[model samples]
Target: MVMTIGLPTQQKTRNNQLYVEHLSDDIQDHVYQAILEGVYKMFQMFGGSLSEVLADPSKKGKLKDFLDWQIPRLRVQHADLLDVFQGVQFLPLDKHAFLRVQCFVNRLEGRFGEIR
Candidate 1:
């Protein structure tokens, strides 16, 4: 005999994609892309690889400093993204910091169309 199971309705209807997936095309193309580029530039300014920085807890403060510097500039032009950032605590590092940053980058890459 074969058995079948169904997911709960709430689980079945849940959206697993990042909030960026729900944004309008223009916002995703312009605003989200700008935010991703800004973050890429900030990673450049950090003078280290993303994995290196994220893996080392000692590097957290330096990463936070870069975010502090970058956020105000982004706020001027990408306030909507900033709001999402704040809502998501995107700039802060917690115990799950590595996963958080990785997931953020992955989502951006997925939405903006990855080069690799």
Candidate 2:
């Protein structure tokens, strides 16, 4: 049976695991809004174009599963900065230390023509 707002969906399986379909369009939008902001975009992992995958219904499950597995893995790997909502802390370092990193970034940008 379908459930209303503020109630969990009920399942009939022995383990009582609720089987949910893909998120409704409204819920998906709200989630995207919460996670991303102006000029910032979600990172895409696979080589295929996001628009191409999203246009086909059959691709959605695989894409969703990949994201579900990858996001948490990324969060754990970058937990220090990922947990922060505001700007990250990279201040109060010695001048040379800061410049060293900056120089590396400058070299990368020179070679790659913008880091993203």
lDDT tens digits, residues 42-111, model 1?
6766557667777898987887787677656764333465543444544556769878778888888888
Distance (Å) between predicted and true CA of 14, model 2?
28
Query: Candidate 1: minimum summed lDDT over ten consecutive residues — where?
Result: 1-10
Give per-residue lDDT, candidate 2, residue 84.
42
TM-score of every model versus the real structure: 0.38, 0.29
Query: Candidate 2, residues 1-116: lDDT per residue as tens digits?
Result: 11122223333544666564433432333333334331123425352456767688788776677667655554332223224443456668798998999899889988997584
Candidate 2 wrongly placed segments (more than 4 Å): 1-84
Clash totals in order? 0, 0
Q: C-alpha displacement of 40 in model 1, angstroms?
A: 1.9
* Model 2 lDDT on a 0 to 1 scale: 0.50
